[model samples]
Target: MNNFVLLEYAAWGISALLGLWMLADLIYTDRTYSEEMLTSSQEGDIEDSLVIDPTQQGGQK
Candidate 1:
């Protein structure tokens, strides 16, 4: 019933909670998204769609 024993139990409880959360998240993601969709390369395509121009956005010249 010392402070160290209480701290150790708290640490174990946090660890168990984190592990269960990660497991649930993994299962949810696996069931919601396909492997190919998760692995698709859409970063560049999204970046190319943006118009980055301070002048056109009403900024000082």
Candidate 2:
């Protein structure tokens, strides 16, 4: 009976630890960028002409 109680306590401790680990992982997962940051990055790329086509530059085929 004492061994069974010890096993139960160990199982509960492991379960609680796993739940806490999962919660922490979810909470610290991604450092999401702001909308303003994304918009500014897109605008900077456009301003730099980073998406221009070489054929279009020569007035097409």
Candidate 3:
């Protein structure tokens, strides 16, 4: 096989390994944690904390 063909195979092999790893990690984490905990996020809390009144940034009209 040519160098290019061999490199292509290597790239595909690496990609397959990475995909498998992610899948396995997902399964392991799901089995190890609760659904609510897995899906829980602080996005709302973060958004609420960023309140910026326009008056605070500049002189009021």
Candidate 4:
């Protein structure tokens, strides 16, 4: 019973440390998004152009 309790405590501690590390990384990371990066030719609808046929070559049988 004591061993199980210790293991559970250790697991919780590790999980908390990992969560804090991820939170810190997210807070410190610099991410930028710009509209100028996209070109006119890259702004087309893809769903209307994609064709899916399972019986076609390179597709699942």
Candidate 5:
């Protein structure tokens, strides 16, 4: 009987640990994805700004 009780507690502890681990992984994944999206958008903005207008260099010769 005592062994059964110990086994039950062990199972509960393992279950709780697995749940926490999964939650942590989900949060981390979401944060990483968001950062990557922000970085990519910022890069696009930089590229657009770098575009040059040849006509703006004062009428062509």
Candidate 6:
């Protein structure tokens, strides 16, 4: 019983450490940015032409 308890504790500690390491890795990773791909004028044009059709029903209707 004592050995089982110790093994369970060790497993819990290792799982917690791995979870923390993954969280830190996700938070500190660098995101890539590209400036030459999209300009302000293009962005505005895209926003203006975008439309949503809410009245379209699925196969049920």
Best prediction by TM-score: 3
**Order of models, best TM-score first:** 3, 1, 5, 2, 4, 6
Comparing 4 and 6 by lDDT, which wins? Answer: 4
lDDT of 5: 0.75
Summarize candidate 1's per-residue lDDT along 4-45 as a digit string, tens digits.
999999999999999999999999998999999788655555
How good is model 2 by TM-score? 0.48
Per-residue lDDT of candidate 3, residues 1-61 (tens digit): 9999999999999999999999999999999999998886555554463345557767477
Using lDDT as the measure, name the better of candidate 2 and candidate 6: 2
Give per-residue CA lDDT, model 4, range 1-61, as digits (tens): 6999999999999999999999887665523433453332344465644343435537655
Give candidate 6 misplaced runs (Cα > 4 Å). 30-61
- Cα lDDT, all candidates: 0.83, 0.72, 0.83, 0.66, 0.75, 0.62
Selected candidate, larger lDDT, 1 vs 2: 1
TM-score of 1: 0.63
Quality of model 2 by C-alpha lDDT:
0.72
In model 4, the number of clashes is: 0
lDDT by residue (tens digit), candidate 6, 1-61: 6999999999999999999999887666533333453232343444453332334433233
lDDT of 3 at 39: 84
Candidate scoring better on lDDT of 3 and 5 = 3
TM-score winner between candidates 3 and 4: 3
- Clash number for each model: 0, 0, 0, 0, 0, 0
At residue 40, what lDDT does model 2 achieve?
A: 53
As for candidate 5, its clashing pairs are none
For model 2, the run of ten residues with the poorest summed lDDT: 38-47
**Stretches of candidate 3 exceeding 4 Å from the true structure:** 46-61
**Lowest lDDT 10-residue stretch of candidate 6:** 50-59
